[model samples]
Target: MLLVLAATGALRGVLDLRTPLVVTILANLLNIALNLLLVHGFDLGIGGSAAGTAIAQWAAALCLVAVVLRRARAAGSSGRPDVAGVVAAARQGVPLLARTATLRAALLLGTAVAATFGDAPLAAHQIATSLVSFLAFALDAVAIAGQTLTGRTLGAGDAEGTRALTRRMIVWGLGTGVVAAVLLLVLAPFVGGWFTPDATVHDALVPALVVVALVQPISGVVFVLDGVLIGAGDGVYLAWAGLAVLVAYAPLALLAGSLGAGLAWLWAAYGVFQLARLVTLWLRQRGDAWLVLGA
Candidate 1:
């Protein structure tokens, strides 16, 4: 499963991820069907789940390959990787690679910190993580929309249109975040019960979820700004800014863990990190730095 996942993940690039996303959806649907058949009918259990996931990943990877090839052909280009092009692409991608690594490390470290708080806290953290992940992925569609549209407008040298589009995207992000927060807040009391049976875990989850709900607006702004910056080709700034955000988050995270403040405090630390991101990205948008016509 991990191997297949890595292969498919490599094909995921650019702001326009529609093809890969559709492939993933189809693959996951197949995985669900296979898991039901193999886990129940064939009695393979956990192994069946792993096998299903692996097959789905492979399917997605294949579909991604097909999509890339088709697009290349449609552009009337030779579908072959050139060494010079590959090297240039790799050079451009270095900062993004570093940024992704740091982000992953922070999340892993956060999970480790959660485990130190005991089973109930860890379980509650998992539930909150799941909810956050779902919301993040959903919100990302809007971010993607912002990225593709903004990139196109800027590339066309339409400064006014780009600004208008950015404003619209920001509004979209704000609106989506607020709606998500309200829904989560309204459902917070009962959501935990759906995920776990232990009263202790459920109790720990409510406040954590409330924290999640409250932070949604902040997260929405950060995520949209992140996509907008990427669209504007601000990779170098983003990479460094991500490192700075991580540095800012580290102290708060350490204090949260050291003080034994549990999941709510930990999430509050995450909120701080997102706030830092929002500020940094907003600052970048205030200048003509990214309006370079040829860049």
Candidate 2:
């Protein structure tokens, strides 16, 4: 995971997104093949599945690293790590880590609440969350573009360029969000059966899926602004803002759980969380403070 992450980050810095995407696809294909071979052929069970994934990840990481090294060689770059630069980069990353951790904590809280509602609710929660997570990758593609371009634009001290990029990405994010929302809603009835044959779980899932579908636009804005702020090196603000939203969200989630609310309500609480995120990020994007121009 670490090696792949490093390689992807380096590739993103050079605006080489295709390599990471290709390697990821190859890795998943390799993982499926290895899992079939190890788990069934060798009868290694779950441990074999784990081993297959581990091997696939390592293979992908090595492939990406080789590509990075070759690129460096071609560019005549030293490929040597500078201690001071490393320290500075790590320092900058700390707030990002905090921001991510807080966001994940909120998700965990939702999962915990879902588990309290019993098997069917929990299953529905899992399915809905998984579907939303899958959709997030598509929406996040625009955010990735925003992040890369915003960083490059800001680094060159082009404030107007940064704003222009943000606006363009926001439009893309909204358009993608609308498409996802429409598709999710249109498929909500039939989608649950695809994941499970259990009628109770499927019935429980549709309402929550609808809630998820309704919030795609909010999610879209939140993700893009998040990437934009990160590109601007505004991690400290992001960390604090994320923590604030989590704090605000916890009570809402708890209340829904305590009231024995249905899956839809619980997911509604998550929608509130996303709304909070949108508010914070939107406010930041409106201001000039996040446009810190420099390396």
Candidate 3:
């Protein structure tokens, strides 16, 4: 993962969009093939899946490094790894990493809490969360685009371009969310069946799935804003905002259980957290001169 991050950051600094996109797509395809081979053909299970992923990631990292070095050489640059540059990048990235880690940890905690409600509720929560994650991941592509464009615009000191790109990418992200929600709602029955043969699980899952579908568009916007802030090097805000949301998890879980709140309330907590982050980011961005539209 570290190597992949390094390769991506370095390549982003030097390469154009098309090259990296092609490489990323091809590498993901290779990784998927490796996953299938190890898991299905060899019956290596989850460990095999992990090993396949690691190998594919390292392979992609090496390829990206090679491409970057070649380009640097062609440009008559030294093609040497800049330790200072890496350090600077790490300084900016650490806070975002912390925020991401904290949020994921809270999610895991939420999962544990749901599991305490028994197999049916746990299964339902898992199905709903998985569906939500699929939508989030799809929208994240647009967020990444926003991040890349925002960074390049800042680097070029083109404030107008940054604002325009941000708005455009946000729209795209929300659009993806809407599409994911619609598709998931339409296919809920089929998807629920694929997860379990239990009619009870399916019954529990249906309502949660609908809730997830409703939340996707809002979550998508939040993710896009997150990407925008990260690209703007506003990781401190991201970290604090994430921490604040995380603080609500334990209390919320306790209250929900004690108050006999349903699975719907738990799912609603996710939407609340996301919405809070979105509002916080929007407020912060609005006040910051650096992030001001066309500033």
Q: Which candidate, 1 or 3, has the higher lDDT?
A: 1
Q: Superposing every Cα of model 2 onto the true structure, what RMSD results? A: 1.6
In model 3, what is the error at residue 149, expressed in angstroms?
A: 0.3
Which residue runs does candidate 1 get wrong by more than 4 Å?
Answer: 1-21, 43-48
lDDT of 1 by residue, 29-94 (tens): 999999999999899999999998888878777767676667668879797768997686677679
Taking the tens digit of each residue's C-alpha lDDT, what string does model 3 give over 1-295?
6666666766765436566677778888888999999999999999889988888888878887788778878889897778998798789879988999878887787787787778898988898878777777788877877777787788777877777887887788788889888987898777888888999888778777777778888878888888888778889888988888778666776576566576777777776777777787777666654462323
Q: Of the candidates numbered 2 and 3, which has the greater lDDT value? A: 2
Candidate 2 residue pairs in backbone clash: none
TM, every model: 0.87, 0.95, 0.86
- Cα lDDT of model 2 by residue, 77-189, tens digit: 79998799899889999999999999889889999999999999999999998898899888998888889989999999999999999998898888899899999999999
| Global local distance difference test of model 2 | 0.93
Give the 10-residue window scoring lowest on summed lDDT in candidate 3. 286-295
In terms of TM-score, the best-performing candidate is 2
Sort by lDDT, top down from the best: 2, 1, 3
- 2 or 3, which is superior by TM-score? 2
